[model samples]
Target: MNMQVWASLFGVVLGGLLSYLAQFTTVRVAGRNEERRQAAQRAEARRAERLELLREFVTIAQEGIRVAEERDQAPDWAAAGTPEWFAAGRSVIDRLWVAERMIQILFPPRLYRLARTYASAVDHVLWRLPDQIAAEGSMWHHLRDPQHEFLEAARTELGAHP
Candidate 1:
């Protein structure tokens, strides 16, 4: 081939190669970006789920505390031993126990331990007799510290710490 023809042929080959490389790189980069976006979405979904579980657990814990307080404050009713009151207290404890198990399965060890401690405290309060509560100056009062600790840990874990 003539010199001019040879140069044109080489130029075409080089341009085609460069174009292919650019397209390849663009596709690879786009693929990576998409993968990263999906990963981030999955992580956000998991965080939202954890937050919801924590909210439920906290609600159950609060209910347990309320039941304990009611039993403690209403000495006459407690002494009369109405089945409904005991039943309510037992139901609260049951729900709290289930919530604690959920936390143990879904949360880290530190958070689970805190949840266990808080649950135990609530259980103690719920099971205490009125006389025992009076002697101890309110079992719910004793539960406050553990509840606060669990809440703080949960907030930190959920990245909503204040």
Candidate 2:
């Protein structure tokens, strides 16, 4: 072949190789960037979910305390087994049940167990409140240590230092 023709062929091959290399590099970099963006979005979503769960758990705990106090102070007409008493009890129990289910679904095993323990303690206290109130005549106080423990565990699980 002529020298000019050989040189032209070389130029064409070099241009094609350079183009391919540039495209490959661009695609690889874009793929990596997209992966990083997706990972960041997932992390944010998880954080939001954890925050929501914490809020829900806190609300449940607060409601449980309120209901216990109300029940303890209720009038004789609203005594245990009455519609008012049962309604108050059901509301607190239902909220606790929902928190328990959420913890089971959203938390790791360790956190789940901690939350479960708190829920169980609250449930036991509520269940026995009527008898305690009847036997002690409005002088009973529910134990709330488990609630504090669960809150601490939940905070730690959500990446808080506490």
Candidate 3:
């Protein structure tokens, strides 16, 4: 072949290779973005589930308050310390633990510490009984602080507001 013809053929092959590489790079970048989008969605679903579980505890707390206030009978401290209430409370607390674990496993320790704090509080309240009933308001006050701190920490860690 002539020199000019050979050079033209080499140019075309180089252009074709460059075009293929550009398209492949675009595809790879798009895939990574999609994966991140899906991960965000999964995290959202997990958060929703965790919040639902927390709502269950709130509902039980409301009922438990009513149970504590009955005029006919004293509060059921016996049941509170029993396996039953512990199981119910554990159900809610365990779900929160799992959800936090799923998020980073180890990065944020706030949730774990918060759960432990409340669990201990509940245990303390459980022991103090109808005596603590007068202090139930105080116990609940302490409970609220931990919950608020945990949520604020979670928002900071997750870059999302509760």
Candidate 4:
């Protein structure tokens, strides 16, 4: 071939190879960036879900505590059949049931166990409170430490505090 024709052919081939390499590199980098962005979005979504569950669980627990406290303040002789007593008891039980379900759904095994234990403690307290109040004349002595333990575990699991 003539010198100019050979040079022209070489230039064309070199240009095509460079263009292909540039396109390949761009596509690979863009794919990796997109993958990273998607992963980050998924992580954020999970964190938000966990936080929302924690908020709901805490609210239910607090409501249960309030009901229990109210029952404790009632007169010791208040019969269980009374409307006030029945309503308070029902409210506490329902709240605890919902909280337990939330824990089972949202918590890891360790945290779930902690929450269950706390629920059991609350249940025991509610069941025995009336008799204890009548006998002891007060509701000052109850095993409520499990509630704090559960709260601490939940907070830690949700990455809310330290």
Q: Which candidate is the best by TM-score?
A: 1
TM-score-superior candidate, 1 or 2: 1
lDDT of each: 0.86, 0.74, 0.56, 0.72
TM-score-sorted candidate list, best first: 1, 2, 4, 3
lDDT of 4 by residue, 1-162 (tens): 699998999999999999999999999999999999999999899888877876766676666656666667656535534687667767867777776877788668988888777777666556564666568543324435676787888778877788
| Residue 70 local lDDT, model 3 | 37
lDDT of 3 at 41: 100
Judged by lDDT, which candidate is best?
Answer: 1
Q: Which digits, one per residue and each the tens of the lDDT, describe model 1 over residues 26-107? A: 9999999999999999999988888888989889988988876776667485474578878988888888889899999999
What's each prediction's TM-score?
Answer: 0.87, 0.82, 0.53, 0.77
Q: Could you tell which candidate, 1 or 2, scores higher by lDDT?
A: 1
- For candidate 2, write residues 7-63 as lDDT tens digits: 999999999999999999999999999999999999999889878887887777667
Question: How many clashes in each candidate?
Answer: 0, 0, 0, 0
Worst-scoring 10-residue span by lDDT in model 4: 136-145
Clashing pairs in 4: none
Q: TM-score of predicted model 4?
A: 0.77
Query: Which ranges of candidate 1 are over 4 A from the true structure?
Result: 2-5
Error of 4 at 24 (Å): 2.1
Candidate 1 positional error at 18, Å: 1.4
lDDT of 4 at 61: 63
